[model samples]
Target: MTTETPAPRHETDVTSGPGAVGAAVAAAREAQPWWAGIGFAGRKKALDAWRVLILRRADELVDVIRAETGKTADDARLEVILVADHLRWAAAHAGKVLGRRRVPSGLLMFNQSATVEYRPLGVVGVIGPWNYPAFIPIGPVSAALAAGNTVVLKPSELTPAVGQWLADTLAEAVDGPRVLRVVTGSGETGAALCRAAVDKISFTGSSATGRRVMAACAENLTPVVIEGGGKDAMIVAADADLDAAADAAVWAAMSNAGQTCVGLERVYVVSEVADRFLRLVGDRAAALRTGDRPDADLGPIVLPRQLEIIKAHVRDAVARGARVVLGGTESFTPPYVAPIVLADVPEDSVALTEETFGPVLVVNRVTCVDEAVDQVNASAYGLGASVYTGDRSQGRRIAGRLRAGMVSVNAVIAFAGIPALPFGGVGDSGFGRVHGPDGLREFTRTQAVTSQRFRPLMQPNSFGRAPGTMQTLVRMMRALYGR
Candidate 1:
């Protein structure tokens, strides 16, 4: 077994205590109304400006992300691209999705005009994860800001610098009260943020940690949006393009050192194509390289603790009669983990059941698409999945049967890039969404307004109503709906 030290702490890292966290929340609460008062158009203008600033400083942001997480430059660049896209989407769509809209008052209440609108929730607390720190936190932060709520972010201790960089850049883009704040520390700081009086909290991490966040928020009866862990699966139909499926499997399973919540951890391929698919996946995974060098395909594992989990899962699978096609426990070299592909891993093995959160893939054979779907749904997590087939309709059909929040047909992790689609999961994967229209509304609450435009023909609300008023109303109801 290879031993690895914990992530190195940086001198520039800021540790926020409870006092500091409380003060940040208080400041956000005080600044929310003014932020909201600017309205959607004004907010959009500011966000657009910020977007430009981010684009101009894209290289710098990428450098900071890569330095903190030890991910490849390409991966870090992808984060910057996604952050800008989500910011633009949230700023542009918030008004249309949350603005007040008129509703029909119905036959009996035609004199009253009714409207419904979503208003900001004042302040939101965001607890970010270490992996994909910038992209993940921006999902909640952009939506919260676009919805007019200031944000207080508590990034993972391992990657505090990335979170602070985001806050500093936003401040440079917009000259006013701090709409986004960063409070850095360990789990205790996150717990404190959850306990604070923020209007809502958006947390992204493991399911185990998410439960604790929920418990903490329960004390204040605060609402929360949890984006937890996922053992996302991919289905390979017999008719699927083996080359395409294999390529996607390799990329999804190994990218970002497989630290993605929506990454492919399990693959269920039909028996007819299992051997060919496995061979292709092994060949491709074997060619990938890992290091901090510019030519490297992937970087070292960001968290030291995760390295052990990856090793345990791989070893348990091998011990349980799984076939190691490419890499195994020997792939461990402290901090850096090479891609490992296992075949026929037992259903009960931790490799198949738990979130390894590393560059490891479990391939299992099934008799048909039905069996593949069953095995995919059998897991406790339901975050994301993909289906590959020659027939688009068949792929769609298989995707519908799988139990997950997002499904990509003939593609991998495509839903995350689209600004209009909501991103989230089910079961142990956690609840609530944070991406598109639903994401914008996640930071706001609905308010219904009704105004009396004119007096009704019958004063049904009055006790001294005229005789036969009830009969007239009954007749009208019968005419409208009792058909």
Candidate 2:
């Protein structure tokens, strides 16, 4: 008797370099029509399946996240939990957000009936970052999937396995393997995805890379969404809660080892409470521990190369006469960086002007909230801001004046948790929202349909119109909108 040889299972790498992008995009486009034809109800069922699996198996997702990113389990948990929440929200809300809506035809087109609806763009490409590997791409992917567009995700090479696992998990639950796929590779893969034939590209990473993504997409005249780097600022008003503000600042600056784009990097406290706020914040920062231990409050900087940037920023700040109120260069122990708080930092220091992306915070004093608002708006990065003020009216007033995309009146990094709030930035920080109704619509194209319901009194559209019709239309235009 002859022994039979087992057949080998094979898989293709859709992330080998520039070549992978085309295959990934093609597969997604081919799958999109059938998936979209299922409409909102079918999509909701699939999304619900994904949400259920993600929540039920959160522990498994957390372990994978920790293994890939080196973030503490708790920090990793937050990302997975938030991703589940977004998937739930997208499933529950996409129907209403993308449903057809009727609108008034207005005076000039009174005889017409008009309605508008969002249609899926067929395929979408997403380039994710390593800091929040399990969470970041899900934002765009969920939104796109909910909108009926298949997605091709290129996760950061640092966390490709996590990306693959995520795709596999969702596909296994919904039996929609072709609806979503992962392409794991370096920057070249991302650039190729942009150049590939896709409806749109959503990128989350440094602003420098965002610019390149935009350039690559431009080659195909493809639309792009970017969530770029930020040097976010915080303001502590004179009437604010010093203790609460300090605690929030320290947590925001040190959370996820300060790898967050919207994390606190600079603070402008009113002169009246500057000293007290600085003392409270410095003490809290100094007390924060960094390690991979289960009980550790903070984790190491996940990206190995980010260490140099962190050290360089600290050195530049010190050279510019910034005083370290807490940890200094000594905190540059490899892998982990203890919380560092600087006081009396020059306005032009690198720590304040650039994204440190580490456990670093710089504090400055302002005479009043107005000056603080102006200073915060002065930064080229208009991603997000936090304002701690006792008065609601003052908080609203200052929040309105800030140029950032989102502002938390009395909290830090609170907007990102609410699934209905559109999260994005203005200026160099990046454009295109990734949550709420706007986010769902971002993956679709608008189609306005108009039908003539009746004959209008003007009848100017017909060549057979009366000679005086043109004069009457001109008179109406002058009466209604000439001013």
Candidate 3:
């Protein structure tokens, strides 16, 4: 969920129009064959060069991310570091993950050998969010390139500078014009990309805008992977490490101003330790700072309009018998929104149900881990969740029952940091995956090829078969199966 707060209302510049969108997609298609022809080894070499370049200029990239997104320097640095790791992983592993592999023919086709390979989807279109501008769009871009497809990316208008930096840096690693191109504009530009003839589209934003992206892609029947909103929860079991869980919740809720798709928004603590958990969480939240300073805990909300949504959620929750245990809506001063912790927030209130893209944490007491699971699963968005328990097995058991796409048993947002892990969500949180082997395949088309190793004793597909062939086959099936 990036800059769904909406871009400035204005007409987009060059490369932001429908004509430019179409031209970029057409150029990507033209360039894809040469990219795929270079083969995995060549692509890997180029991608590794790209990684080296990013590492060398990582400081510059981090500064751009922080400057554009208003996230703390360390937070922005984390994203840059993570993206570098993924670039390395994708380039190094794409061959093994997507290469053709032999498959045993089933009994009916024993005379044949089959194999499957993942082929590039030609041209890939990506629309990224502003929150994690450098990392979010780059996930799809790297996977697509590694999978041998050319890419055309449209970054959030709010952070086009970072997007431009990424595209330009990648271009230095290769000798191509439009292998990767950046388009900057409002929703209209995104709409143009969706309407353009692209093989697939990868979008990360609000569920509402994702729906619109899906609708626009439907005109061309372009397949899409929508990485949308999440009202993720943090479960605190009776046997959990209270201090660790509280600390994790604090960073998860307040870091990046809680604008993360998998950020912690709700907590369901067992009644036995609910009070202690609340105290710890409140202490951590109260101490956290959100200013434009160098050493602040977090930064301002990049999207200006997100303040209203944050304000409305806090106001609604307070109006419905909820108490602000820490900061309130009054702390919002334009882009900077301090962490706001709420207690006894109603189950159906906006604070609990909606995606308040701000530093807000809501706590609810559960009778047991089972009740906590039930409460967490009740959310409409299930992108990700975190479970804290002293018993590792109990954490796994609870994690298995949660409907989120990713679950971190002992840590918060650990799955995202692992480049080999498949990251995405189920239901409204969005469908499809990015990162890992699944991510490599996400932008590819599966092709199954077969070869006849020997002549079949009986050719059922042949018209020259004897009249009694059907009768004999039926008898053989009955004898083999009808015991």
Q: Each candidate's TM vs. the true structure?
A: 0.98, 0.94, 0.96
User: Model 2: what TM-score?
Assistant: 0.94
Report the lDDT tens digits of candidate 3 across residue range 35-130.
Answer: 999999999998998899999999999988876777888899889898899999999999999999999897567899999999999999999998
lDDT of 2 by residue, 1-483 (tens): 000111111233433656777887888888888899999999999989988888888899998788777888889999988999988999999999998999999988998999999999989999988888877888899999999999999888777777888888778888655798888666777888998969999999988889888999999999999998898999999999999999999988899989898899999999999999999998888787788677888877767677888999999999989898988999987889988888888888788888889998999999988899889998989999999999989898999999999999889999999999999999889999999999999999999999999888779889999889999989999999999
Quote the lDDT for 175 in model 1: 74
User: Cα deviation in Å at residue 195, candidate 1?
Assistant: 0.8
Ranking by TM-score: 1, 3, 2
What value of lDDT does candidate 1 attain over all alpha carbons?
0.90
lDDT score of residue 290 within candidate 3: 77
Candidate 1 ranges beyond 4 A from true positions = 1-8
Q: Answer with 2 or 3, whichever has the higher TM-score.
A: 3
Which candidate leads the pack in TM-score? Answer: 1
> How many backbone clashes can be found in candidate 3?
0
